[model samples]
Target: MLNTGLLELHSDCQNCFGLCCAALPFAASSDFAIDKNAGQPCPNLRNDFRCGIHTELRAKGFRGCTVYDCFGAGQKVSNLTYGGRDWLQAPETAGQMFEVFPVMRQLHELLWYLREALAFRGAESLHDSLKLMLEQTLMLTTLSPEELLKLEVHIHRAEVNELLLRASELARSTARGQLNPAPKRQKNYGRGADLIGAKLRQADLRCVSLRGAYLIAADLSGADLRHADLIGADLRDTNLSGADLRDSLFLTQAQLQAAKGDLAAQLPGSLQYPEHWSVKL
Candidate 1:
């Protein structure tokens, strides 16, 4: 399969059946304005399977929806798995479709990471293995709903994470060699650290691994995050004004959407500046 095909793994809301809004349950919390039950269509969901308040979700206190990404699983199940049929069209199949959507979503997320791992030139030695894993993941995405529900996705994810860790190490090691020598004290390693509301402004985080770190409400303004791996890092309310994240790895749109930043924050090309961000540097 073509590597470019992997790009389609991103969400295509127009082609989706609003599976997330319908299948996932949410409570009235800081993220959502109202409680929604599993398999129930969200109140804002239109008959066309589009959000009635899509442009104003944040303003309406539905920020949770804005940060959610199904990794293209919605369309894959709506069109391919269910053959373009929807819950309304085929009520009998609705239950199984919802069950299968989350499973497919997990598989698609793995595909996203595997594709990124394959693109890491620093991990060239692991290219063959990465490609093999990508192929295996692609095969899983094509499985029927029955097969997908039977999948132990966590087992495969653990295996892929092993290779991804190696890739991360190689990439960071190479980046470190290229950076100017600095005092050892400036080095920061906060992998899986509880850094919520921690003061980290202007910190030297270059070539660091903040994977799965809880950075919510952390002050990261002007911090050097070049080549940092931010996969699964909680960035909500983190002040990123002027932070240098130009080459950070595994930074997704959802993470960026959840965080607060200004125009001066340098992001990788794969991501776009949030429109709500302040223009001030």
Candidate 2:
């Protein structure tokens, strides 16, 4: 396992150009107050690159913005890639910068998981492979804006995902193996299966795959999710009080931010309880 921690995956907005508020388009809904086009700066963005309503996002109907995670890609693009170039000052460079932000974000997100996979005690044998992929993904984040825009990120993601799966399986197997006389686990769910609002409290979900699962508003309070893979799982409004997710695979801070959880939700050491867990938008 590499010595690097996941702290770098946390977004540092002070060094960013509000790329997410500019580069990503959003439809007006519960998450956003108005429809905004891609490449357009959000109206709430201040000239200094800070959210105008950062402290009042949830109350202002922009709860989505509060949870948006760039995985440190914003600062990487703003400082490392562009050398502190302010997009507003260089109109000619704005387009390329905006285009490169999402690509860099994806690479960083992959790097985040790859780094976590390396730390899984049960995946020791896969550390070398995970390290290589992590380095490769990190290198991709350093490409020039033009090159970044042209990268076949989806193809790269597919390759990295294969390794991630192997690592997840190894760790999950070890986790479940530790559970002597384990309880029954649901086996029918697949990627993106609809489980919205389903009552799953106290379910034995260890060593299962909830990848890309639509678990919106699901009642998962007190669920045992040890080593369950949660990659791409939609956790918005999911009740997670008392859920055991300390070893859950590939769970990101963004996922936790989207879900409804409390201090009782056992999270991986690298994660924190979101401050707005009880705030209703």
Number of backbone collisions per candidate: 0, 0
Task: Give the poorly placed runs of model 2, Cα more than 4 Å off.
Answer: 1-7, 278-281
Q: 143-172 in candidate 2: lDDT tens per residue?
A: 888899889999999999999989988988
lDDT of 1 at 132: 89
Judge candidate 1 at residue 98 and give its lDDT.
85
Worst 10 residues of 1 by lDDT: 182-191
List the candidate 1 regions with Cα displacement exceeding 4 Å.
2-7, 181-190, 278-281
In model 1, residue pairs whose N, Cα or C atoms come closer than 3 Å (at least 3 residues apart or on different chains), thus clashing, are none
